[model samples]
Target chain A: MLENFKFVLSHTTHPGNIGASARALKVMGLSQLALVNPSNFPSAQATERASRADDILASAQVFVTVEEAVADCRLVVGTSARTRTLPSQLVTPRELVELILQQPARVPVAILFGTENSGLTNDELHMCNYHVCIPTNPEYSSLNLASAVQLIAYELRLGFAQTPELPEQRILDNEQPISREQLSGLLEHFDEAMRKTGYLKQNHEKQIDIRMNRLFSKANLTHSEMNILRGFLRSVLYRCQ
Target chain B: MLENFKFVLSHTTHPGNIGASARALKVMGLSQLALVNPSNFPSAQATERASRADDILASAQVFVTVEEAVADCRLVVGTSARTRTLPSQLVTPRELVELILQQPARVPVAILFGTENSGLTNDELHMCNYHVCIPTNPEYSSLNLASAVQLIAYELRLGFAQTPELPEQRILDNEQPISREQLSGLLEHFDEAMRKTGYLKQNHEKQIDIRMNRLFSKANLTHSEMNILRGFLRSVLYRCQ
Candidate 1:
């Protein structure tokens, strides 16, 4: 559900913020990034700031305008640090999350963030179904662009849990998420199969095993998913023999 | 309600993040920010990033360690982007907000955000009553330092609104917070009385007044308390006269 949301930054002036926004989106498991007429993109500074989040920047789609960036999106949300006399429905980030969850069918939702200086232009706000103002200190509300993105992204990630219980899956009921102990067994199987298949050379470093553990840990594999993977590993070993 | 919360960023590497963090806190109407052994501070980069919110940076209290930063705080909450094997009560950001609001009496609450590369060390995390995660993308959970503070500060603000009218506030009704202006007048009275009593010397710099403000700010004084202070000040003046 979170993957369908694309974070769109319009007329961003700093490439570093662009990079930071990418990192923020990725941290929350949201992948889509759209930049509308950024000042300096594809720059070294942006890359440096992105760190391991380079994949997000590399795959980031650049569009000519906000409309173009969110053309396919059904639900558009524009973030502003200050409240303005506007027509769009105003909601807090959490409220926006509840609003988004009401219609699960809305694929490819777009969350818009304006340039650092001024927030979304009037026209852009008009386009959004909802306008979100991060309740900030009225006296000193200079929220950096990427910081705004990070908070919204965090809220979206949270909304994933707040959403109404997902329709039950037939397979999921019988197969709970596998325990870490079970996952470790799967890794050992992979190590044995890979070693016999000459996939891992003699005197192979433990780094490969460590990475396999990390990769599987992220999979959040279910019991059935674990069986399928283990079955595939057995087949590979049989073919090698 | 939000005044008791204090944000602590530990072992921070970039001064810019520190300045950004100060802005983050102030914007949320949260005034307290404590830094633990930052790599660089009072740096030009931090000042530049802070923009007009330089006062938050200037008044920011620095400490040599996390323990010292949070020593005065009763409820310590640590931020973690990853799931660890530790035994602390892991909660979503919203849950932490709810928990903090549950006990309105827990003044000087500390929320700790660790360094950039690594999150809070096990020792540091153990110190927290709750381990809060912002619920980021599991694939790449690398939230920047100041951005982390911004997200937490934003939640704390929202939580303040969501918090059911604090029950303790009923007992505190007679002690409703006095404005900074009122607090200032009380400080001036203290200064004159102390001077008359041979404590403050002639042309003493404003350091004593500054310390008094810090002291009373923590007191969260009520209207009657302010009146008592003023009455005491009047008695002292009469004696001096």
Candidate 2:
């Protein structure tokens, strides 16, 4: 899947972004990188930024135009903050992943990024099969080139990452079930103890019983928990007597 | 809603990104800034990068951990390039805008950004209920931290920029509700009853009382709801007598 997809940077002005892009792609298990006339292709800054991902840099293909870069690719995607003058289909990064996954594995896919100052030109955008827009703050939608790359790469990685099917949850082993009779008996014992301590008057007994039931229901007392509670109630009754 | 939202940049490493993020937040009408474990906060380099937007830097909260910075916020959203080990609902920046817009004005929402080298850790991501991913180039998708902030902030601004219709609240004007004094009195009565039953003996009554108050306040009991509770309590007291 990684071999079929190629990342193309068109006229990237910053050497740092180019280098950072390499690192981002490598982290996501992608290696193919195509440069379309980068301003500073073989710069020390890009190499420094690439960190340990220089292999992507060494094998990077340099292209003269966006069309030439993506000419051989069966699929082409362009990234933008908003819709362009071109009439290409728009998809979010998440949707794009689904689209990418459904495509034939043999076909080469090309993702194009534009220059730093302005994004892909209208003609450049028209060359792509679809447009991918990253939703951003309308007021300040100045997403840096490399950050955009990272998000897309992250999505691709997530889409292609080996997903193990979750194991089914084990059914609870029922040792014993708390019977209604036992519950009623426990409630009666609690009420008698409360009466001895003047915790409940005649008018309040029903309300107290309701509250107690609510509390017990929330606790989800198992058989063992009910037994423990009953034992505690017996001790209270003994003290009251 | 946009005006009320605060963009907090926590523990940012690069001074330039800090400055850029400040600009991003200000443009989106989000003013609050919180910095956790920043490498060089209040640095001249950051101030220079901030350009004319100094207010974001001035009011920024500095903290040692992400928790301290976002303690008061009811909702927290973390930005990440990769999915963390912890479970979190992933959303695109656009969807996040809609979520933020729907929140009550009383609740403060926090957006967290991690260090430049590594995005938010798994632990940090766990703190957030939602994660925002910005789409970018697959081959060179290394997004700057500030740019990620910019995209999210931009989405938030767009979502909240419009005049919001008033939230429709269910009204029960006919019901006679308990006042704050009445509620306190009821709580005191309950505490007295609990003491008589020995339920309050081992527990820190003051702390429990405070927690109960918080829980009740969060419930936003209507007049009818208060009446029902009071009626139940009265019945309990009557039964005890």
User: Which candidate ranks first by TM-score, i.e. highest?
Assistant: 1
Q: Candidate 1 on A1-241: residue-level lDDT in tens? A: 8879999999999998998888888877778999999999899989987878999999999999999999999989889889879788899887888888898888789999998898888889899988888878777778888888888888787777443322222343424667889988998887776565554553344756655565566445556456644654554455445
Q: Candidate 2 docking: what grade?
A: incorrect
If you score just chain A, what TM-score does every candidate get?
0.66, 0.68
Give me the candidate number with maximum lDDT.
1
Misplaced by over 4 Å in model 2 are A101-106, A164-241, B1-9, B20-32, B44-59, B63-68, B76-106, B113-241
Model 1 stretches with alpha carbons more than 4 Å out: A161-241, B161-165, B169-241
Candidate 2: tens digits of C-alpha lDDT, residues A1-241: 6567799999999898898788767766678899999999798989987877888899999989888888899999999865546678899888888888787663698989999789998788878887898765555565667667766776676676553212122323321445777667767766775665455553456655775654444333345445443543454444455
Best candidate, DockQ: 1
DockQ of candidate model 2: 0.13
lDDT of 1 by residue, B1-241 (tens): 7778889889889898888888788878888888889899989988887777788888889999776787666567788766665324567777787777665665667899988889887657655656677666555767888888888888888888456667754555444445444555777786766565444553344544433433344344556556654554454455445
lDDT of 1: 0.74
